[model samples]
Target: MREQTGLGKVARRQGAATLNPIMLARDGDSRLALYAAARDHLRARGYEQVSMRMFRAPHAPEQNGPSYCCQNDGRIAARRWPALRAALPAHIYLWLNAYDRRGPGYYSAEDLAWLDAIDPWFALNRRPVPSRGKACLAGELSLSVDGDGELARCHFIPERLGNLYTDDLADMLQERSCPRFKCDCYIGYAQRKDLPFQRVFGTGVLARIAPEQ
Candidate 1:
């Protein structure tokens, strides 16, 4: 498929052909069809391990635009979640993180309520809420690097910490408290001291996980 071809070319160029690639699908009526195609394409490439992420809105409105807003259409997504899970291939693992309404986008009380309702569903599936004693390991354990080598706590936070090319990598790796008040993204929160992600994924938390039977 065209998508697979594009991914293959990019992976080859980046020397990441051996790494497991995750296909992200946005929530919508047609997402099932998209996921099925992606599944078939990846499996055809002899990828026994595959990961899929569902994109929800209000997280990156500046880039995703108004159409990606799930605040208003969350019920539709909630209805589709079960079927999407059921349709997954036995060898593919999937994860859904609740949207925390970041960015300049607006989320009303009703939208927040929708999030409150759906977050538990995500928890029940695998992703869990951090307990009170859990410390978020955002800046300490995870960071994002832009193409220019500038670093940030994560993609959600744009404040640059340092440049990987110019600065000492060791100094930049210091553990620090998260600047944000809340983080719901998996890449950010999965590093929480309380999450079982480490036990479940071991050293491959960033890329691979055992597929559920």
Candidate 2:
């Protein structure tokens, strides 16, 4: 599968990977926070900063697809592993995550497959990072659970429930899957329009929870 626009031809290099120095950005989080978390994660692991281009995290409709955080070549936020790692210069791996499933947005197997064609290991933001939900989350249908626990299932007919955390993106992944598909996290949240939240737990506050289109 080929990418349509915005970012195209996403691929990866050959080498042993390190899931240490990571960046996860989700709703309610800021780009600054994302960078700090990534930097700290790497620093603790003995990695240093080289060239970090922390942009005003992408917003809804601004992104191209389910895995928009990846670069045209599907590298972490398009950091171009070699270049971004130049300053600190270490054979390390970085992650650019987003909100999770059961939050808002319909990330299905087919959608995930398309993302993989962009990047083999392009993971889904399965870990449900706490964030504000888009009042009008657009997708096949809204299938999610809020902090208070609310569910919206059914592509055509919708169903709402209280304390609905049963359908997590991680658990959803288990129901159906593709062998080659790779997204480390299980869930992610969509971006908020008004004000963003502050986080420091490797997500929300920092670039731990990567936001997608």
Candidate 3:
């Protein structure tokens, strides 16, 4: 499963008018375009075990709706295109699973291929993303929030900072750290190392803030 920073939650909390029906519609169109791009990329690589399903939101009710169970076979992009299309938002949360029966390394290869397909889309639309001095293991460059409204380090490792109602986010980000050696997961590292600040964050914010360790 892949999710961005809790921007959706923040948007809802802030009551950002940007999530209106008109914005959602535009975002839906972008999702469909990316879906077509991903499907084509997989087919070209001769991968057939991959499947994609879109949910309205993370942990959304199963019965509520899904875009469709799109596979390599000719089942089209989505089921009930009109209804499902409208449900997608600018930030999509994807639950990717590979059932490649061919051999090992199947899942990862397919995942990388999918990332290859969507990376360009993210790059082209990328904007100036604010980041703390250090990067978290999660794909996005932002903090997660705990149930108590406190800032969290990461979903996998949930150490809470003081509540947002009282504490400073900048201070919280400064205080957080991983227990083990630094997390070097693929997506995390890609954002921190492989891509340039221009490609990822629109400007040199990361490079400027983070001098060589």
Candidate 4:
């Protein structure tokens, strides 16, 4: 399911006083205003850091359902890159998933090239971007736990490594190598060993935001 658009309502319901809420923005200029409004709402509520992740195709279709696939239609055109970049507020850090050997939502070679070209823009504007090329921290530094306590390597990969309620957490975490060969999700790849997450966000790389300069 897509993230709810009611930023204020979500904050209130979750008691997000100290929470850094991450809003999802679908790829396109049409939704920029909606996300910008959400960003403003969060900032007004004393949230110094609000992140926005660009929606990628659900890697777990069995869980997300077939109808949720809209990667191609939702993809932002290369020609619209400048407009999209300009429209986003500086405070809202945007994340893009690297193109990988995946389906439906997989970014094309051209898209990767576009990402290379736009890397400087993100850097110049002080926005957070992933390190170039493939990298993964899944099943290594982080783990995803479902509502039922099923533990997985990452959110994108649904293969259950173990159950939190039944299995030893330490044993479950023992396997450093991921069951999958590749990871295309930003949440998975952003924590690459080579990435400067520790230097930027400290130990709380998953939740912490880089402080403004």
Alpha carbon lDDT of each predicted model: 0.52, 0.33, 0.41, 0.51
Model 2 lDDT per residue over 74-172, tens place: 323443533454553232224433333244454568656655444322453434323323231212223543333544332111233323555444332
lDDT of 4 by residue, 39-107 (tens): 777667655441253333323234343222334234435577756756866543345433233466355
Q: What is the C-alpha RMSD, rounded to one decimal, of candidate 4?
A: 15.7
Model 4 TM-score (2 dp): 0.41
Better candidate number, 2 or 3, judged by TM-score: 3
Query: Which candidate, 1 or 3, would have the higher TM-score against the true structure?
Result: 1
> What alpha-carbon RMSD in Å does predicted model 1 have with respect to the real structure?
14.8
In Å, residue 112's CA in model 1 sits off its true spot by 15
- Superposed by TM-score, candidate 3 places the C-alpha of residue 47 at a distance from the truth, in angstroms, of 34
Provide the TM-score for each candidate, comma-separated: 0.44, 0.19, 0.31, 0.41
Most lDDT-accurate candidate: 1
lDDT value for model 4 = 0.51
Query: Whole-model lDDT for model 1 versus the true structure?
Result: 0.52
- Point out the worst 10-residue segment of candidate 3 by lDDT: 93-102
Writing each residue's lDDT as its tens digit, candidate 3 over 77-105 gives: 42344345247452332222222232554
Q: Which regions in candidate 1 have their CA more than 4 angstroms from the true location?
A: 1-84, 87-92, 97-121, 124-134, 157-159, 211-213
CA lDDT, candidate 4, residue 70: 35
